[model samples]
Target: MTDTLERPVDAEPGRMNTRPAWLALFGAIAAFASAALIWICRAGDPSVHYVSQLGATGMPTAPLFNLALLLLAVAAVLVDRATIARGAGYVVGWPVATTLLVCGLCFGVASVITCSPGCPVPFTPGSLVQDFVHISFAVLGFVLAIVAMGQVAALRRRPWMRAASIITLVAVGATSLTGAMIALFKGDTVLGGNLEFTAATLAIAWFGVFGLQVFADHRTARRRAARSHE
Candidate 1:
């Protein structure tokens, strides 16, 4: 007798299901759009960075931007769950999910706790705790996003997904780096802000592309299944 191997019902020989990718894309778009709106609304202020503006107490629109971040976080978690359901192992899925969840929670918390006066300035001896928490989440969320991108790139078997993962990694990296530079060295507000915005745009664009790819894959799979039935 010969030993037999079993494959998952939805598993394709060389491809992973892309449904999750689409979800992630949606989340990315929502987050990106929200961030863009926030930036545009605050562009007039010569003294404020996008990150700082997000939590600034005086900014009436801060809550809306924070809401966007929360939505993005939710989308990230959904993407992770979808990937797992499609048969990517526990190892690949959990970290992504956890990171996204953490990011989401952080955003949700930060949204309600608007920062005190002089927020973008480094937290000094008397800076409010809310400002510290807000900054922490902003930095950590981007860092985790970078990690999730790398994880997705490594675990996904599809060529397009892998490619998107790489692009996302680069975009997130640039965004994170620029954000850090702005925080640490207090770099040129205009240039750093622009670069951060560009990087974020690239990341969102990749999410949209990934979603399209996954949708295309879903269509292709359906066609193949139909042919096989015939």
Candidate 2:
């Protein structure tokens, strides 16, 4: 009886597990650690120099920063795969998976094609084509994260997740918008840099939290299934 009851939860192939959650957490920690190392290695005013500048070509921190992005990309990809394994019951499933895939791609592209020194805005004076590409993809990645958050917010079955996603969507959207406006209008000032970093940190942390939620939801579903069988 116990075996029969537990079969649905334990025997299912490709069920969302703890690995992806741990990967997400590790990725977030690595990104923050790399950023801290970059700051320590290169003394620059965070307000004036954007985060991308730390990872720009020729900077001492470039390798570490780029590696961090790659880790993040991997984490996103793994999370997307786990989400897909949840099957059709997941609300906005395809959209969330697609957005995560695109976000991962963007992060990978940005890691490989780092910007020039100063990380100038796209199409501005002294900005290289690669700079334009890097910035565009990075911005798109964050925007897509916001999209995914909105989609997750629609998960009515998961009230905690819905509420958390809504809050994150608002906070990340506000910070990203403010930073983007400052970058576009006034160039990279201290305020813009701070806001940009804030948005990124929030987004990355949310991703980690998202992984935890996925794990919790899966466990809860399994337990409920077992109880129903009993």
Candidate 3:
């Protein structure tokens, strides 16, 4: 007797689903748009303030920034479904995907319940309970995303996936350390804020790269299938 392997019901062998790729692209665009809007709407040097401060209470960019977060959350949910539907060649497992979904939900919560000005953390003077809640949501979301990336990197199946994940993890980690130093020791605000922004941009770009990879896989599969028929 010979053994046959099972495949996802929604996916044809060797064919990559394009929905997740498209969703990720859309999410990245929305995220960048929100950041851009903040830069344009604000008066002071954006590099000196935390990114969250742009969306804090009474800021001109707050409304659109929050709106973008909501859009991203929606995109993330759709991406999760699309990823599962792809059924093959996806780097992360369902557990990791679920983690991403939770990360998206956390962003949504942060959008709805924004922090006060300066976006102070818990137990700080002039900090409201909602501020802590907002910060918690944002921190949890980013941490989960980093964790998911680490999990995918551990797979080491695709060279590009592994490299991208590792690079993003390192970039994010380095900036996070700077951010901590700024919080703890009054480090260079400009450097910390700029590094934080750059890390976030890199993460979003990497996600877009993943989407493009899926698209490439789809094209390759089509080419192979066509050659087989010929």
Best by TM-score, which number? 2
* lDDT for residue 169 in candidate 1, whole number 0-100: 88
Per-model TM-score on C-alpha atoms? 0.71, 0.80, 0.79
Whole-model Cα lDDT per candidate?
A: 0.58, 0.70, 0.64
What is the TM-score (0 to 1) of candidate 1? 0.71
What would the per-residue lDDT of candidate 1 be over residues 1-230, giving only the tens digit for each residue? 00111122264655545565466556556555655665655564545555556447776655666665565556555554543343433245465556556655655565666677667444587588877887777666666666666766775456677787897787778776876588569787777866666665565455445444444444555455556656
Our model 1 lands, by Cα RMSD against the true structure, at: 5.4
Model 1: residues with Cα > 4 Å off, grouped in runs:
1-29, 39-47, 89-95, 204-230
True-structure lDDT of candidate 3 = 0.64
Instruction: List candidate 2 segments past 4 Å from native.
Output: 1-48, 225-230
Better of 1 and 3 by TM-score: 3
lDDT tens readout by residue for model 3, 1-230: 00111223234454535555466556555555544554554445453367777778987678876776665565455455545544543444455557768977988898899989878878989999999999899888778778867866776456777788898999888888777788678777777777766665565455445444444444444455456556
- Rank the models by TM-score, top first: 2, 3, 1
How far residue 65's Cα lies from its native spot in candidate 3, in Å, is 2.1
Once fitted onto the true fold, the runs of candidate 3 whose alpha carbons sit more than 4 angstroms away are: 1-25, 28-48, 88-94, 218-230
Clash-forming residue pairs, model 1? none
How are the candidates ranked when ordered by lDDT, highest leading? Answer: 2, 3, 1
